[model samples]
Target: MTPTVIIQLFVFLLAGFVGFQTITRIPPLLHTPLMAATNAISGISLVASLVLAGSNQGLFSTILGTIAVGCATANVVGGFLITDRMLAMFKPAKLEAKESVA
Candidate 1:
Protein backbone atom coordinates (compact mmCIF):
# COMPACT_ATOMS: atom_id res chain seq x y z
CA MET A 1 0.00 0.00 0.00
CA THR A 2 1.02 3.58 -0.59
CA PRO A 3 2.39 5.76 2.24
CA THR A 4 -0.70 7.96 2.10
CA VAL A 5 -2.98 4.94 2.50
CA ILE A 6 -0.95 3.71 5.44
CA ILE A 7 -1.12 7.09 7.11
CA GLN A 8 -4.88 7.29 6.59
CA LEU A 9 -5.37 3.82 8.05
CA PHE A 10 -3.28 4.68 11.07
CA VAL A 11 -5.29 7.83 11.73
CA PHE A 12 -8.58 5.98 11.37
CA LEU A 13 -7.48 3.27 13.79
CA LEU A 14 -6.25 5.82 16.29
CA ALA A 15 -9.47 7.77 16.13
CA GLY A 16 -11.51 4.62 16.63
CA PHE A 17 -9.50 3.66 19.69
CA VAL A 18 -9.79 7.11 21.21
CA GLY A 19 -13.52 7.30 20.58
CA PHE A 20 -14.08 3.88 22.08
CA GLN A 21 -12.09 4.71 25.19
CA THR A 22 -13.82 8.04 25.66
CA ILE A 23 -17.27 6.53 25.35
CA THR A 24 -16.51 3.65 27.69
CA ARG A 25 -15.37 6.00 30.44
CA ILE A 26 -18.65 7.93 30.67
CA PRO A 27 -20.95 7.22 33.62
CA PRO A 28 -24.36 5.69 33.00
CA LEU A 29 -26.08 8.91 34.04
CA LEU A 30 -24.35 10.85 31.27
CA HIS A 31 -24.84 8.31 28.52
CA THR A 32 -28.21 9.66 27.40
CA PRO A 33 -26.91 13.18 26.85
CA LEU A 34 -23.78 11.91 25.17
CA MET A 35 -25.83 9.69 22.90
CA ALA A 36 -27.99 12.65 21.93
CA ALA A 37 -24.92 14.69 21.08
CA THR A 38 -23.42 11.83 19.07
CA ASN A 39 -26.68 11.49 17.15
CA ALA A 40 -26.30 15.07 15.90
CA ILE A 41 -22.77 14.30 14.80
CA SER A 42 -24.04 11.16 13.07
CA GLY A 43 -26.65 13.22 11.24
CA ILE A 44 -23.89 15.42 9.88
CA SER A 45 -22.03 12.32 8.76
CA LEU A 46 -25.15 11.06 7.00
CA VAL A 47 -25.37 14.30 5.00
CA ALA A 48 -21.72 14.08 4.05
CA SER A 49 -22.17 10.47 2.98
CA LEU A 50 -25.16 11.47 0.87
CA VAL A 51 -23.07 14.04 -0.94
CA LEU A 52 -20.28 11.55 -1.50
CA ALA A 53 -22.65 8.90 -2.80
CA GLY A 54 -24.32 11.33 -5.21
CA SER A 55 -21.08 12.70 -6.57
CA ASN A 56 -19.98 11.30 -9.91
CA GLN A 57 -16.90 9.65 -8.56
CA GLY A 58 -15.31 6.44 -9.82
CA LEU A 59 -17.14 3.12 -9.40
CA PHE A 60 -15.08 2.11 -6.36
CA SER A 61 -15.63 5.45 -4.68
CA THR A 62 -19.35 5.32 -5.41
CA ILE A 63 -19.64 1.88 -3.84
CA LEU A 64 -17.67 2.89 -0.78
CA GLY A 65 -19.69 6.08 -0.43
CA THR A 66 -22.93 4.14 -0.70
CA ILE A 67 -21.77 1.82 2.08
CA ALA A 68 -20.83 4.80 4.22
CA VAL A 69 -24.28 6.27 3.64
CA GLY A 70 -25.96 3.06 4.75
CA CYS A 71 -23.81 2.77 7.87
CA ALA A 72 -24.32 6.41 8.82
CA THR A 73 -28.08 6.18 8.27
CA ALA A 74 -28.24 3.13 10.53
CA ASN A 75 -26.17 4.89 13.16
CA VAL A 76 -28.52 7.88 13.23
CA VAL A 77 -31.65 5.76 13.44
CA GLY A 78 -30.23 3.40 16.07
CA GLY A 79 -28.97 6.32 18.14
CA PHE A 80 -32.43 7.88 18.22
CA LEU A 81 -34.06 4.59 19.13
CA ILE A 82 -31.61 3.98 21.95
CA THR A 83 -31.98 7.54 23.17
CA ASP A 84 -35.76 7.27 23.21
CA ARG A 85 -35.57 4.04 25.19
CA MET A 86 -33.17 5.61 27.65
CA LEU A 87 -35.45 8.61 28.11
CA ALA A 88 -38.43 6.31 28.56
CA MET A 89 -36.80 4.88 31.66
CA PHE A 90 -37.02 8.30 33.36
CA LYS A 91 -40.72 8.98 32.60
CA PRO A 92 -43.33 8.74 35.33
CA ALA A 93 -45.50 5.64 35.15
CA LYS A 94 -48.65 7.76 35.21
CA LEU A 95 -47.47 9.82 32.26
CA GLU A 96 -46.64 6.70 30.36
CA ALA A 97 -50.07 5.23 31.09
CA LYS A 98 -51.79 8.44 29.93
CA GLU A 99 -49.76 8.54 26.75
CA SER A 100 -50.52 4.91 26.08
CA VAL A 101 -54.25 5.50 26.60
CA ALA A 102 -54.31 8.45 24.27
Candidate 2:
Protein backbone atom coordinates (compact mmCIF):
# COMPACT_ATOMS: atom_id res chain seq x y z
CA MET A 1 0.00 0.00 0.00
CA THR A 2 0.97 3.61 -0.58
CA PRO A 3 2.43 5.57 2.32
CA THR A 4 -0.46 8.01 2.26
CA VAL A 5 -3.01 5.22 2.40
CA ILE A 6 -1.20 3.61 5.29
CA ILE A 7 -1.15 6.90 7.21
CA GLN A 8 -4.81 7.42 6.54
CA LEU A 9 -5.67 3.96 7.81
CA PHE A 10 -3.68 4.55 10.96
CA VAL A 11 -5.45 7.81 11.59
CA PHE A 12 -8.82 6.18 10.97
CA LEU A 13 -8.11 3.44 13.47
CA LEU A 14 -6.82 5.92 16.04
CA ALA A 15 -9.95 8.03 15.69
CA GLY A 16 -12.18 5.03 16.15
CA PHE A 17 -10.33 3.98 19.28
CA VAL A 18 -10.48 7.43 20.82
CA GLY A 19 -14.13 7.82 19.93
CA PHE A 20 -14.98 4.55 21.59
CA GLN A 21 -13.14 5.55 24.76
CA THR A 22 -14.87 8.94 24.84
CA ILE A 23 -18.37 7.56 24.54
CA THR A 24 -17.77 4.84 27.11
CA ARG A 25 -16.02 6.99 29.71
CA ILE A 26 -17.97 10.21 29.52
CA PRO A 27 -20.62 10.58 32.22
CA PRO A 28 -24.08 11.88 31.35
CA LEU A 29 -23.73 15.08 33.36
CA LEU A 30 -20.41 15.88 31.72
CA HIS A 31 -21.55 14.95 28.25
CA THR A 32 -24.19 17.68 27.98
CA PRO A 33 -21.83 20.44 29.06
CA LEU A 34 -18.99 19.13 26.91
CA MET A 35 -21.27 18.93 23.91
CA ALA A 36 -22.45 22.50 24.50
CA ALA A 37 -18.84 23.70 24.45
CA THR A 38 -18.15 21.72 21.28
CA ASN A 39 -21.20 23.35 19.69
CA ALA A 40 -19.82 26.80 20.45
CA ILE A 41 -16.49 25.90 18.87
CA SER A 42 -18.22 24.54 15.81
CA GLY A 43 -20.28 27.73 15.52
CA ILE A 44 -17.04 29.67 15.33
CA SER A 45 -15.74 27.33 12.65
CA LEU A 46 -18.94 27.83 10.64
CA VAL A 47 -18.56 31.63 10.78
CA ALA A 48 -14.94 31.40 9.68
CA SER A 49 -15.96 29.13 6.83
CA LEU A 50 -18.59 31.60 5.67
CA VAL A 51 -16.06 34.40 5.66
CA LEU A 52 -13.58 32.30 3.69
CA ALA A 53 -16.24 31.30 1.21
CA GLY A 54 -16.80 34.96 0.34
CA SER A 55 -13.13 35.43 -0.54
CA ASN A 56 -11.37 34.87 -3.87
CA GLN A 57 -10.07 31.53 -2.70
CA GLY A 58 -9.19 28.40 -4.63
CA LEU A 59 -12.02 25.96 -5.37
CA PHE A 60 -10.45 23.19 -3.32
CA SER A 61 -9.97 25.44 -0.31
CA THR A 62 -13.52 26.68 -0.47
CA ILE A 63 -14.90 23.20 -0.78
CA LEU A 64 -12.80 21.96 2.10
CA GLY A 65 -13.92 24.85 4.29
CA THR A 66 -17.54 24.17 3.47
CA ILE A 67 -17.23 20.51 4.30
CA ALA A 68 -15.46 21.31 7.55
CA VAL A 69 -18.23 23.70 8.52
CA GLY A 70 -20.95 21.23 7.69
CA CYS A 71 -19.32 18.38 9.61
CA ALA A 72 -18.63 20.56 12.63
CA THR A 73 -22.17 21.90 12.67
CA ALA A 74 -23.63 18.43 12.44
CA ASN A 75 -21.37 17.16 15.19
CA VAL A 76 -22.24 20.09 17.41
CA VAL A 77 -26.00 19.93 17.03
CA GLY A 78 -26.39 16.18 16.85
CA GLY A 79 -23.92 15.53 19.65
CA PHE A 80 -25.65 17.94 21.99
CA LEU A 81 -29.07 16.48 21.28
CA ILE A 82 -27.79 12.96 21.76
CA THR A 83 -26.03 13.93 24.95
CA ASP A 84 -29.19 15.49 26.31
CA ARG A 85 -31.14 12.35 25.52
CA MET A 86 -28.51 10.17 27.15
CA LEU A 87 -28.59 12.31 30.28
CA ALA A 88 -32.34 12.02 30.38
CA MET A 89 -32.03 8.24 30.38
CA PHE A 90 -30.11 8.37 33.66
CA LYS A 91 -32.47 10.82 35.34
CA PRO A 92 -35.60 8.67 35.44
CA ALA A 93 -33.71 5.70 36.80
CA LYS A 94 -32.05 7.79 39.46
CA LEU A 95 -35.34 9.38 40.47
CA GLU A 96 -37.02 5.99 40.84
CA ALA A 97 -34.17 4.65 42.93
CA LYS A 98 -34.23 7.76 45.12
CA GLU A 99 -37.95 7.40 45.76
CA SER A 100 -37.61 3.75 46.60
CA VAL A 101 -34.70 4.31 49.00
CA ALA A 102 -36.40 7.15 50.87
Candidate 3:
Protein backbone atom coordinates (compact mmCIF):
# COMPACT_ATOMS: atom_id res chain seq x y z
CA MET A 1 0.00 0.00 0.00
CA THR A 2 1.03 3.60 -0.52
CA PRO A 3 2.42 5.61 2.39
CA THR A 4 -0.70 7.79 2.47
CA VAL A 5 -2.99 4.76 2.71
CA ILE A 6 -0.84 3.28 5.45
CA ILE A 7 -0.97 6.49 7.44
CA GLN A 8 -4.71 6.77 6.97
CA LEU A 9 -5.22 3.20 8.11
CA PHE A 10 -3.10 3.77 11.17
CA VAL A 11 -5.00 6.91 12.06
CA PHE A 12 -8.32 5.20 11.50
CA LEU A 13 -7.35 2.35 13.76
CA LEU A 14 -6.14 4.74 16.45
CA ALA A 15 -9.31 6.73 16.27
CA GLY A 16 -11.42 3.61 16.54
CA PHE A 17 -9.53 2.48 19.62
CA VAL A 18 -9.66 5.89 21.29
CA GLY A 19 -13.28 6.48 20.45
CA PHE A 20 -14.25 3.12 21.81
CA GLN A 21 -12.38 3.72 25.04
CA THR A 22 -13.71 7.22 25.54
CA ILE A 23 -17.29 6.28 24.85
CA THR A 24 -17.18 3.24 27.06
CA ARG A 25 -15.75 5.26 29.96
CA ILE A 26 -18.49 7.89 29.83
CA PRO A 27 -21.27 7.71 32.41
CA PRO A 28 -24.63 6.57 31.16
CA LEU A 29 -26.01 9.99 32.11
CA LEU A 30 -23.77 11.64 29.49
CA HIS A 31 -24.74 9.51 26.52
CA THR A 32 -27.59 11.80 25.48
CA PRO A 33 -25.39 14.85 25.26
CA LEU A 34 -22.78 12.87 23.40
CA MET A 35 -25.36 11.71 20.91
CA ALA A 36 -26.57 15.26 20.35
CA ALA A 37 -23.06 16.53 19.68
CA THR A 38 -22.26 13.68 17.32
CA ASN A 39 -25.50 14.30 15.47
CA ALA A 40 -24.46 17.90 14.79
CA ILE A 41 -21.12 16.71 13.54
CA SER A 42 -22.82 14.14 11.36
CA GLY A 43 -24.92 16.90 9.84
CA ILE A 44 -21.68 18.58 8.77
CA SER A 45 -20.52 15.30 7.24
CA LEU A 46 -23.81 14.99 5.41
CA VAL A 47 -23.20 18.37 3.79
CA ALA A 48 -19.75 17.35 2.70
CA SER A 49 -21.10 14.10 1.31
CA LEU A 50 -23.74 15.98 -0.64
CA VAL A 51 -21.06 18.14 -2.22
CA LEU A 52 -19.10 15.05 -3.19
CA ALA A 53 -22.14 13.30 -4.62
CA GLY A 54 -23.12 16.33 -6.68
CA SER A 55 -19.69 17.07 -8.09
CA ASN A 56 -18.61 16.05 -11.59
CA GLN A 57 -16.21 13.57 -10.16
CA GLY A 58 -15.53 10.08 -11.54
CA LEU A 59 -18.15 7.35 -11.40
CA PHE A 60 -16.52 5.54 -8.49
CA SER A 61 -16.19 8.72 -6.46
CA THR A 62 -19.76 9.69 -7.15
CA ILE A 63 -20.99 6.26 -6.08
CA LEU A 64 -18.90 6.29 -2.94
CA GLY A 65 -20.07 9.80 -2.12
CA THR A 66 -23.71 8.84 -2.58
CA ILE A 67 -23.27 5.95 -0.23
CA ALA A 68 -21.62 8.24 2.29
CA VAL A 69 -24.56 10.62 2.03
CA GLY A 70 -27.06 7.87 2.79
CA CYS A 71 -25.03 6.58 5.72
CA ALA A 72 -24.55 10.10 7.14
CA THR A 73 -28.25 10.85 6.81
CA ALA A 74 -29.15 7.71 8.69
CA ASN A 75 -26.59 8.40 11.38
CA VAL A 76 -27.80 11.99 11.92
CA VAL A 77 -31.46 11.09 12.00
CA GLY A 78 -31.02 8.05 14.22
CA GLY A 79 -28.81 9.92 16.65
CA PHE A 80 -31.35 12.73 17.01
CA LEU A 81 -34.15 10.26 17.57
CA ILE A 82 -32.20 8.43 20.24
CA THR A 83 -31.12 11.69 21.88
CA ASP A 84 -34.67 13.04 21.93
CA ARG A 85 -35.95 9.83 23.47
CA MET A 86 -33.26 9.95 26.10
CA LEU A 87 -34.08 13.59 26.89
CA ALA A 88 -37.76 12.75 27.14
CA MET A 89 -37.02 10.38 29.97
CA PHE A 90 -36.05 13.36 32.15
CA LYS A 91 -39.33 15.22 31.63
CA PRO A 92 -42.21 15.27 34.09
CA ALA A 93 -44.76 12.54 33.50
CA LYS A 94 -47.57 15.05 32.94
CA LEU A 95 -45.70 16.83 30.18
CA GLU A 96 -44.76 13.56 28.60
CA ALA A 97 -48.37 12.37 28.55
CA LYS A 98 -49.58 15.69 27.11
CA GLU A 99 -47.05 15.56 24.30
CA SER A 100 -47.90 11.97 23.57
CA VAL A 101 -51.49 12.94 22.83
CA ALA A 102 -50.66 15.87 20.59
Candidate 4:
Protein backbone atom coordinates (compact mmCIF):
# COMPACT_ATOMS: atom_id res chain seq x y z
CA MET A 1 0.00 0.00 0.00
CA THR A 2 1.00 3.61 -0.53
CA PRO A 3 2.23 5.69 2.39
CA THR A 4 -0.99 7.69 2.34
CA VAL A 5 -3.07 4.53 2.51
CA ILE A 6 -1.00 3.23 5.40
CA ILE A 7 -1.42 6.48 7.28
CA GLN A 8 -5.16 6.53 6.67
CA LEU A 9 -5.47 2.93 7.87
CA PHE A 10 -3.54 3.70 11.02
CA VAL A 11 -5.70 6.75 11.72
CA PHE A 12 -8.90 4.78 11.16
CA LEU A 13 -7.80 2.01 13.49
CA LEU A 14 -6.71 4.49 16.14
CA ALA A 15 -9.98 6.38 15.97
CA GLY A 16 -11.96 3.16 16.23
CA PHE A 17 -10.02 2.05 19.28
CA VAL A 18 -10.28 5.41 21.01
CA GLY A 19 -13.97 5.73 20.29
CA PHE A 20 -14.64 2.25 21.62
CA GLN A 21 -12.73 2.89 24.80
CA THR A 22 -14.33 6.26 25.36
CA ILE A 23 -17.83 4.97 24.85
CA THR A 24 -17.30 1.96 27.05
CA ARG A 25 -16.20 4.20 29.92
CA ILE A 26 -19.38 6.27 29.93
CA PRO A 27 -22.00 5.60 32.63
CA PRO A 28 -25.05 3.66 31.51
CA LEU A 29 -27.38 6.51 32.44
CA LEU A 30 -25.70 8.79 29.92
CA HIS A 31 -25.89 6.41 26.98
CA THR A 32 -29.18 7.71 25.63
CA PRO A 33 -27.99 11.29 25.21
CA LEU A 34 -24.71 10.08 23.86
CA MET A 35 -26.51 7.92 21.32
CA ALA A 36 -28.62 10.88 20.23
CA ALA A 37 -25.53 13.00 19.69
CA THR A 38 -23.83 10.19 17.83
CA ASN A 39 -26.86 9.79 15.59
CA ALA A 40 -26.45 13.36 14.41
CA ILE A 41 -22.78 12.76 13.71
CA SER A 42 -23.64 9.58 11.83
CA GLY A 43 -26.12 11.51 9.73
CA ILE A 44 -23.31 13.84 8.71
CA SER A 45 -21.22 10.83 7.78
CA LEU A 46 -24.10 9.49 5.70
CA VAL A 47 -24.10 12.69 3.69
CA ALA A 48 -20.36 12.47 3.15
CA SER A 49 -20.76 8.89 2.02
CA LEU A 50 -23.42 9.92 -0.44
CA VAL A 51 -21.11 12.52 -1.92
CA LEU A 52 -18.29 10.03 -2.21
CA ALA A 53 -20.52 7.45 -3.81
CA GLY A 54 -21.77 9.95 -6.35
CA SER A 55 -18.38 11.38 -7.23
CA ASN A 56 -17.78 8.90 -10.10
CA GLN A 57 -14.58 7.70 -8.55
CA GLY A 58 -13.01 4.38 -9.47
CA LEU A 59 -14.77 1.09 -8.79
CA PHE A 60 -13.02 0.43 -5.51
CA SER A 61 -13.82 3.84 -4.07
CA THR A 62 -17.39 3.60 -5.24
CA ILE A 63 -17.77 0.24 -3.51
CA LEU A 64 -16.21 1.51 -0.32
CA GLY A 65 -18.40 4.60 -0.43
CA THR A 66 -21.50 2.49 -0.87
CA ILE A 67 -20.51 0.36 2.11
CA ALA A 68 -19.85 3.46 4.16
CA VAL A 69 -23.28 4.79 3.31
CA GLY A 70 -24.89 1.56 4.45
CA CYS A 71 -22.94 1.49 7.70
CA ALA A 72 -23.66 5.13 8.49
CA THR A 73 -27.32 4.77 7.70
CA ALA A 74 -27.54 1.73 9.98
CA ASN A 75 -25.71 3.57 12.74
CA VAL A 76 -28.05 6.56 12.59
CA VAL A 77 -31.17 4.44 12.56
CA GLY A 78 -30.00 2.08 15.26
CA GLY A 79 -28.85 4.93 17.48
CA PHE A 80 -32.24 6.56 17.31
CA LEU A 81 -34.00 3.30 18.01
CA ILE A 82 -31.83 2.59 21.03
CA THR A 83 -32.21 6.13 22.32
CA ASP A 84 -35.96 5.95 21.98
CA ARG A 85 -36.08 2.65 23.82
CA MET A 86 -33.93 3.97 26.61
CA LEU A 87 -36.09 7.07 26.97
CA ALA A 88 -39.21 4.97 26.99
CA MET A 89 -38.02 3.16 30.07
CA PHE A 90 -38.24 6.42 32.00
CA LYS A 91 -41.75 7.32 30.86
CA PRO A 92 -44.72 6.58 33.08
CA ALA A 93 -47.55 4.55 31.60
CA LYS A 94 -50.04 7.31 32.38
CA LEU A 95 -47.99 9.82 30.45
CA GLU A 96 -47.83 7.51 27.49
CA ALA A 97 -51.60 7.07 27.57
CA LYS A 98 -52.14 10.81 27.81
CA GLU A 99 -49.83 11.48 24.92
CA SER A 100 -51.49 8.80 22.82
CA VAL A 101 -54.95 10.23 23.49
CA ALA A 102 -54.03 13.69 22.32
Best by lDDT: 1
Candidate 1 per-residue C-alpha lDDT over 1-102 given as tens digits, one digit per residue, 9 for 90 to 100:
999999999999999999999989999999999999999999999999989888988888889889999999999999999999999999999999999999
**TM-score for all predictions?**
0.83, 0.54, 0.88, 0.74
> Where does the lowest 10-residue lDDT sum fall in candidate 1?
53-62
Instruction: Note the Cα lDDT for every prediction shown.
Output: 0.95, 0.79, 0.94, 0.93
Off by over 4 Å in 4: 1-17, 98-102
Better of 1 and 3 by TM-score: 3
Off by over 4 Å in 2: 74-102
lDDT by residue (9-96, candidate 4, tens digit) is 9999999999999998999988888888888899999999999998888998899999999999999888888888899989999999
RMSD of each candidate relative to the true structure: 2.0, 6.6, 1.6, 2.9
Which residue pairs in candidate 3 collide? none
CA lDDT for candidate 1: 0.95
Off by over 4 Å in 3: 2-4
Candidate 2 C-alpha error for residue 7, in Å: 2.0
lDDT ranking, best first: 1, 3, 4, 2
**What's the lDDT for candidate 3?**
0.94
User: Residues 5-101, candidate 3, lDDT per residue (tens digit)?
Assistant: 9999999999999999999999998888888889999999999999999896899989999999999999999998888889988999999799889
Query: Which scores higher on lDDT, 1 or 4?
Result: 1
What are the clashing pairs of model 4? none
Instruction: Please give me the total number of clashing residue pairs in predicted model 4.
Output: 0
